[model samples]
Target chain A: MKLYLGVAKDIVVKRTIDRRDQKRVLGNLYDYDVVIKYEIENFKDQPVILDLAESMRALRSEIGVNNQRDVEWELVADSTLTDKLDEKKSTADQAVFHVSLPLRGKDDKAVKQTHTIHLRIKNEW
Target chain B: MKLNGILTLTLALLATMPTAAKNVDLSTIPPRDTVQLTIYNSEDLTLVRETRTVTFKKGVNPLQFSWANTLIDPSSVDLRFKTHAGELELLDTTFPHDKPQMLYWAVRSEMDGDAELEVTYFTSGISWSADYVCISDPAEELMSFDGFVRITNNSGEDYADAQVRMVVGTINLVEKVRELAQRGLVSRDEAKDYERSRRKAGAFKADAKNELLSKLRADFAMAENAARQPKKIVKEGLSEYFIFSVEGTETMKNGWSKRMRLFQGHNVPFRIQYRYRPQEYGEQLVRMFLLRNDTVSRLGSTPLPDGVVRLYRDNGRDGLSFSIEQQIKYVPIGQEIELNLGRDPEVIHEWVSIRSWRNAFWFRRHGASVYYAPGKGHRIKINDAVVGWDEHQAWVERIRNYRDKPIDLQIRRSFDGHVVFRSNLEPSLNDYRSPQLTAQVEAGEKKELRYELVFHQGHNQKQTNVTLESVN
Candidate 1:
């Protein structure tokens, strides 16, 4: 059987504030965060090593649907899972990633998500 | 002209016949003599009026008008005798329960002859929009401006050989015309109530309509004489609405759009300036072209409607370069029009902080419940904690203009907290928190502006505002 990798429908996305530092500098860029909890299903008969490097690159355009002039998004490199997924998993695993966003002025405090992210899998080999 | 299957009229001579009779003597459908469409841009509404001549016998004549598959408001259908108003009487009107999208007008004629009848109704799915094209000379001192109006028709009816007029004002409506049109026909009781209310307001409408018709006739006469020339849009001001009547008749089919030139002007004088409004245009210096909407700019005959403006510049080599495309709001007469052309690479602006320091410390004594500034007739305690201080900072701004001509520049900077701004150049307070500076730079010249700011922090802050002061 060939390897099958598909995006799960139980993904969650939210807009939050960055809390990595105790003292946030005034006028600091990237003060907000877009947290995404995504899951991938693998149903291949044999165990397959899913390379996390190529998958991370494909997720850039999928998460940038809500980008605007004042509000932007960029994936955090260190927070992504660098491990591989095992085959024949029945929706038992998930991964989370953080995207840095920016905010300015008093009126930009209540930014809402206006679009949804739809992800699809592209099989290689 | 033919009615194009959009409107159908059937006349029944009901002499000595019962009201419930089904079969009657029916006359042939008559062609429309003239039609006029008055479209309002602020709403999805169009007032259509058509006139046709019909031969009526010296008895009761029932006329049926049907608008199937059209966006015509049934409640707004009205009929009036244009030629024999005194001789013909509209006895009653009806909307049959079996038939939809139609109405009947019973006319009792006293004489046998040809009488011209006018039918009017309101409709939806027709709208008009205005847009402009501006071409500037290489020197950027003059431009050619052309305005156009595009009319879109989607009302499921074709208007052939019709006079079109567009209105440029907003009117209040209790309900949308499209909603009423989509609701199909109303019941007999509701139709009677609507007709009664319309009759009560007929006097005011008649006066307004008469004024509009008189002006339109004068415009039409002028257009007829200039038939050999290019098409011209005749403009008139009526009450609060501005009307633009297009010359000649147009055949507007469904799902089609027609564009007509409204006006054109050449050699319209304009000026250019560079502005540095960080809050509005981010952190870059933007170039702008400014002009007035008055006679000096050759465009003050009427107010300009809100529309998109596409700007292009002559490259002085028999070619044009696209500059910018932007949307502008409605510009009244004598109002200035500012077009921002974004950032220019020829002009550069830089801001740098050169120095910073702190002084004027305020200390709060431990267990003393009092804070005092240094050297205020109080003995200083080494154990006292420093609670407040004043921070001083200096900044230098530079602007380089590389264009072949002189340029005027204005810069605005905003500061927060209790602050005092001191500068070598004269500065004015744009608001409570921002200071504005204006200067002129010659071509190939670089100018620098210096200013210092003092921020009072913690217990030393007296108020939260910026005060501008000139330094000798």
Candidate 2:
């Protein structure tokens, strides 16, 4: 499996100095549109539905995603024509992740960040 | 019958007597044909030249000029004819022994027609100065500079539709022109000589004619430059002076001032410099904008007159700072113009005297003791005393850049005495004329520089020898 972290660069947007008023402001701070994806190859069996949920839960915790509405996960399209996966099936051949994270400081003010995401994959039997 | 004949004879004699001719009133002077006001920046001195056509009766006409309630220097007043130089002759100028603030010009005109006469005089309470406003971009590499000229007139005389010229240079005057105007007095000896000359020749021609002739020549030389341009200041260099003539004629009433825009520069390149000097500014770094006044820097067409500069930052918005009043410095063409814009919170400066010690000693002399002698009334014996000590002091200067971006901060140290020993940071500039030391500090960095100095006491030695012997 290969990990692809996309759009992790810093983005700056305008920030007001005073919280009550929007007229007075300083320089701008950028925003980040983060996209995290995992590419898996040569999988003989479908992954358990609980494994997919557990992996996402651990990934969210590792990345320290600020908002819950920012993360989006979906199954990769079924490329093999041998077996047709059910529409309601929870198992997926591959996984794709998308996130919209705002690097912010106190009072939800946009700020510059040098954050790093640490992901560890472990198999315990 | 005899009494009636005598009354008739008296009545006939009264009727035959001619009427006495009335003296000309000086108040009904004609309007000015052409007027030029040359204002000086260094002093409240303005030279006025006004030409008017006056009808003179061929004989000696005592033309009176009064400047009551005006700041006109009577001694500096001059009058001459622009046309009919040979036909019209000025005999002399005299002030009435009783009438104050009035002058009489005895002119002998060979022709009876009108002649264009020019009157030149120096007056007080008229001055002009230059000022500017500068706006800079975020990076501080580009700016817009606008220049203006402020003219103030309080000469007690209204100048209507007068051409104005601002002169930038020092004029050597034997007496303060303003004081002379206020005194309203002239040397009686000179007036006596003028009165005597009037009886002999048409006018006493001395300083008045020389001054008028020189001014006329200068005016003719500037006319070529002024005629080419209309509604704009014609700038030209005259020997060691610079003259700026305003484009259109403006009315200058007494106690009134007018501000006229001179020039403007857009997108002119500039540099932001941070300066620190402990003696000049205590523990603070001043921000200054440096720009070159040249064609390469988008300025350099003419020398910039000294003026006040108001700085602003255009960060897609407007921010106004206090205006900086600069001295009357002539920014020559292709020279750098530096405007200090107050202090900057981004750069911090710290200074301290780290260490000091005393090391040298010397001797001193005292008063003499007096004693009675056989021959002489008193004999004096000289006495001498000696004291020794050396004073030494060391200083450390540290400057830190708090801003995230890199900056080359300039630090100037003006030592009260010469530096005996120095360390840290090679001196970028050492000007002994001003006795200033200059260095630059890097951005987001703190630079520490130390210097040791020594002082000698109770010594008859040369001052420069102290720095040589104490090589810390």
Candidate 3:
């Protein structure tokens, strides 16, 4: 089983190539890049942060390996979004992210996974 | 050849008829021309009679009747071609083998035309009850009573422009109407029992009808001798039962209730009294409105069905105000009905004097010196063994009349145990059954009734046995 630390989604870019023998090179390819943009908050300790960063690097290497398009990733930790999530958790409210999944094609390229998490805290003290 | 063509045309017309030998479409039955409901309130039974016009063929006509999803008792269905009975003859009725809820009727008509058919059957879940409202005068001696009949229909059927009749009596129903309607759900033994009971009910119905017919004939003979008058309610006596036919037709929809005025009597004579029965009602002085159901008292033609009767008192205004509103029970015909109107706070009665005394003829326990005998040195031995003891109780009841007019206050004072009583106030009718005192008190008058009661203890106080001699 391949271990993944973050959600992977497809990013599609439609292009018209002007290369010499572009027609022979199959310009209208329906492939997509496996891009990952992950946000994590309130790590609680340094070990949790280190483990999450290491999982992210492992996820990047394993994803889009047997595919045509190249894979990319970006991680935003302890940002304003994470601070807002922490504030909502302290005030006993719900904090969640709304994410749409990517569509997959028959090409032996990008495979994606999506995950959603909801957090609620009863009291701050 | 033309005659054969005419015969072929007639055969084709008969074959093409849509309603022949098939499930009757409900829409083809046509609207009811007249409908009547005879509701027996004692049982959850209503006999419905409906008349509708149907077109029949020249020779044989098959008519289908279906009552699906309704609470109609299929066994009691009866149909008759009321009009054109001589021309339209009912041959036979057959229940289809496949459809459980439909029955077909074969009628032979001499000529093809429109004929009216009357269908009657018994259905459950329709009920009616009588209610009354009475307003008393200031003196509480006269009242105005209004009786209303409330009819409720929940038999899953709608009855429009139906003439309603209410029966008032005990109808002995062994099996419930709903059970009979769903007879297939019952066991075979239960169905046998139901059949026996249904036969009994049929016999009772026939007897009641015969009695009613004889009574009506007698009444008609009596009517010729007496003055003929218009009766608002067409009441008929069915031996042990009485039925009242309401005047106008009413539209009774499914799951709906409607109340109509049955009768109203003005200046009905009544009496207001106070009663106190400690053994029954506990320290409350219940006020009662008493009335007689007779012609002299303004109400007596039929036996009143068991229902609610409300009473109200006018608050000295001409036709404007009323107080002391209370609901009571139904008053049967020709009987004196007593309606309790709760407690009376105005004309109050309380214990003003209470005196209890021990009779000197019997000895009672009095402290430690009870066994001491004079000159006998504690060997207190009487010639005859002490039999029993007696206690006499006395009381003086005071009643203050606060009403502006004189009121006849009847008081009933009951005791918990047996007592021999005598009073200064003369009981209207003195008997061992129920002794009561009646007093006519003027306005703002305070009257007192003194009475004495002697309680007896039995003589068999001890059984003779051998005693140990001075063991202590």
The TM-scores of all predictions, comma-separated, are 0.68, 0.61, 0.59
Clashes of each: 0, 15, 0
lDDT of 1 by residue, A23-93 (tens): 22111111333333333323322223332222322232333322211111223444333222222121111
Estimate the TM-score for candidate 1.
0.68
Candidate models: Cα lDDT each:
0.69, 0.57, 0.55
What are the per-residue Cα lDDT tens digits for candidate 2 across B390-468?
4455666667777776666666655433334444444543453122335566667877766655544434223442122
lDDT of 1 at A107: 48
Top-DockQ structure, candidate number: 1
lDDT per residue (tens digit) for residues B320-434 in model 3: 3434444445556798877876677788787632444433232223333243322233332323222243445555678888978777766665443345556656654333434
**Which has the higher lDDT value, candidate number 1 or candidate number 3?**
1
- What is the full ranking by lDDT, best candidate first? 1, 2, 3
DockQ score of each predicted structure, in the order shown: 0.01, 0.01, 0.00
lDDT of 1 by residue, B1-472 (tens): 4433357767876664344424545666877888778887787888887888988889888887888878886666778899999999998776654566766778899999899998877788888888989999998999998899999988888888878888777765555677767766655444543355345434224334434445544544454333323466877765667777788778888888999998997889999989999998898999999989899899877778888899999999999999999898887779998889999999989875544545676777878879866646655465666667677776777889999899999999898999999987889889999999999999999988888888888788999999988889
- On lDDT, the leading prediction is 1
Task: Kindly give the stretch of ten consecutive residues in candidate 2 chain B with the minimal lDDT sum.
Answer: B4-13
Off by over 4 Å in 1: A1-125, B1-5, B16-26, B187-231, B356-371, B375-392, B414-419, B454-465
